[model samples]
Target chain A: MSDAAGDPRVMLRCERLSVRRGRREVVHDVSAELRAGEIIALLGPNGAGKSTLLDALAGALPAAQGRIERRGRVAVALQSPDLARRTVLANVVLALAWWGVPRGNRAPRAREALRAIGAEHLAARPAATLSGGERRRVHLARAIAVRPDILLLDEPFAGLDAEVRASLLEDALSALRSATRATLVVVHDRAEAWALADRLLILIDGRLVATGPPRELLEQPPSLEVAHFLGFDGRLDDGLEVVLTRPAHVALDPAGPVHGRVTRAIPLEDGVRLELELEHGRLYTVAPLPAPGPGDDVRVRLEGGVRFPRFEASAPVPSTAP
Target chain B: MRLIWDELGKALPMIFHGNPQLLDVIWFTVQVAVVATAAATLIGLPIGLALALGRFRGRNLLRALANASLALPPVLVGVFLFILFSPAAPLGFLHLIWTRRVVFIAQTILALPFVVALSAAAIQALAPGLLAQARLLGAGRLQVSMLALREARIGVIAALIAALGTSLAEVAAVALLGGNIYGYDQTLASATLYEVGGGYYADAVAIGIVLIVLILILMCGLGVLQQQGNGIRMRFRSAA
Candidate 1:
């Protein structure tokens, strides 16, 4: 949403960054800008170079081509915290020490940071003794303790339970909101990122396929690759493809064009989701109508339906190398 | 039982009443082993780290060479160093033959592979992704190294202790290079050999007992390091 690449608030910028593993390039020509208070969700499937790009941005991996500029310090909370055999307090303090914080100030500042993350009780505990959730919190504390200008997290909420995942996501976003730190997080779930990210970058096989505000891209993706990744399944029409809207966007209407026989119905807290057998294919849509039995005929109003007449996805995704 | 008691009885006076010759031999042995172990640790640590962390060609070859060195007979290493220090050899220009310096060289050679192989294995056992995470957290090269070394501290201590044990019990190398000269370059191991060859079996047995005691002390050190190492490993498992 914030395309302030040339503004003074830009914290980190990658100008056509390319990263290689051995002799083969894994990230190709990925240009993006992170500005103050901006949260960019980098979404891609497995092996899409999300980790490589995040590592390059954090300066952990070297760029094989192009450049990355940072206005100030950058910190990262990697997937594995890679904790040392030290107490939590000492671990966070070591991070500050690595950033050249003065010896007299290291412990105090680290303690304050741990407190801010609600981990003060874990200060004296060994880092290797913390649970996955606790370790992730400690990692976040360590990253923010240095007061970095740009923060990169590699699947920070990965492997967490649903409740822990939600809590950590909220805490991390709150931390970014409180500071001017620009954060780039690599996530696999597109729907969650769509709702949360101010801006989004969709990568497929190390190539940038789309970048825009998450809401904007959700409503209209520039490429079919992005649309599929965002859970927008489609019927291959001749010149125009019909997109199936999500369950929450579908409604029951007697005068609608699409008709189907319900095969399965699931009740949501606010509405009901139905698995309808349409003439073209099966569609999973939601409606506020009374619970429809398995054999009931239903007419669905497609409130969020979209048509793509300009982009044809008959060929494989092209590599954006040059 | 009688003979064993006689041997211990006959050697006790020499030990308790302060035999300067025996003490000098023991002190010389300890000095050589200590200096050799120190030198081996200082030089082999970096080599071990390189072999463990460095990604390049011939790294496995280096590790293999180090492992092969461990199987090399002490007598062969002794002969190799003896010939290198001989008058006809190029290194003979230093004229370091048949001196305690030569004994130090032999003892260091005998102990070096232990330090390298064990320390490298210890470093390799570090938790994965530690280096990348450290760099991401903004650690410099030295800081990253320090952090990894700290994680592997117990293994490194065990390596040093194992190397010390090897150096302390060495007799063939020191005898070949230093010539077992009494009150000069002679060590506890060499003196034991000297007493055994000279028919003083009781004195030899006494020195042999002392060497066993030294090994026991090292075993105690290894036990302590193991306990500490296990504590950290358990903590790591719990976190996982």
Candidate 2:
């Protein structure tokens, strides 16, 4: 709903965009503006119209209603490779060719594009034979080959290993940052979205529920639905309500407001996540040092927290007494 | 069995010795099939691409019509062409009846539907994701169609071979429309029929043997092309 000039040149503008399939509206009155030099991550649950919105933006499907204004060319890299049964280089070359890049110069340009995505080594392999991660890289290279003003990626990291996913994300983000283009990435992982997105748009049931900076969305989480979406559970205790985000967001302390014994400890790459059962059978996921083993008495606390409204309290609380 | 062996013996010598008559029939079959295939390709590629890529109304009807035409018996197609090119038909003024050209035209029509239907299916079989990718790469309608065709090249080649095979083995259409004039319309199929009618069963059998050999060779050649096309496509994709 912000004006185009307030942000980067509105590369793509969707106003009240709606798409229907078989009499059911899959995308309902969704409006978003993709500005140049910005990366917007469309986050949602499965079948939440994330892919449908990308499809509509890419002009793959007709909008049931509303208008989409695109200032310049927009490129899309689908989750699938979709490359011809051609060599990796040829795939990029073909995309370049499609963009009317002359024949003589396309080879080097294609090579450059492939190199940008670190797929140059795979330039000779059959695209079909490349692993899912490799194919996605090639697809991304081909999309970038056109130097599109707007790029739409649908779950580009779905099947990639962590290293490959990180590399690809870095490559895509770096490229978009340098170019005068806007990118819209659809991802289900909050951590990945947080890393790559400058802005986040959450869609629930085909409706855009929240749009803001990633941290803002994560911190406040517009509503209970959004909080639940952020992987949080709300609990009521002693006429007070507590909302616990993911275990990764919670930290433990001996003198903290909430105290509990560590029930489970799962070691992560950077830190160990502890699953603690607070008094009254309330469970919380938090990062705590010297993590108490299962059955070890430990105190816990909420840090960088907010008041969480209790929506329901029908069940009796289980005693946390040992 | 003796008759069959005798016919085989005679046909082998003629084919090995490069007999002009036998060679002529072989040459004629290849020429007609190739020309017909080419014409069909010209017409069918565009039609198939259009049918598969177009967003217009009645696309399904057009597809159905093309598919239905694939089942059109060669004889019926030949008869239809014969009527059109005959002295009494509406297109009879051109006097094209009983000529190799007439046979070529009839065979092309016979092959056209096969090419269009099969090519359309090949193009249609390309993953929707591929088209979406191409469009996102700044490919317009024609570029997307070309990309789809390229992606389905192996399928297209297979379709081409199927169409060619249908035309090569076709007899009724050439016989009815070609008039089987010696050295002109007298293809292997028509010659075999002629020799059989004249009671020269050995020569008829020889032509049959030659026809079978030619068809086998064509099949082998198509197989090789397909393999090579596949190899090239694989290499190219991997390099990407």
True contacts kept of each: 0.68, 0.84
* Candidate 2 regions with alpha-carbon error over 4 angstroms: A1-8, A234-242, A249-281, A286-299, A311-322, B16-19, B233-240
For residues B130-205, write the lDDT of model 2, one tens digit per residue: 8877766767887787777777778888888988888788888888888777777777877888888888877788
- Model 1 C-alpha lDDT versus the unseen true structure: 0.78
Which stretches of model 1 miss by more than 4 angstroms? A1-6, A191-196, A234-240, A251-257, A262-274, A286-299, A310-322, B1-20, B55-57, B225-240
Estimate the TM-score for candidate 2: 0.87
- lDDT value, residue B131 of candidate 1: 68
Shift of residue B24 alpha carbon in model 1, Å: 2.9
Chain B fold agreement for model 2, TM-score? 0.92
lDDT of 2 at A253: 59
Residue A34, candidate 2: C-alpha displacement in angstroms: 2.6
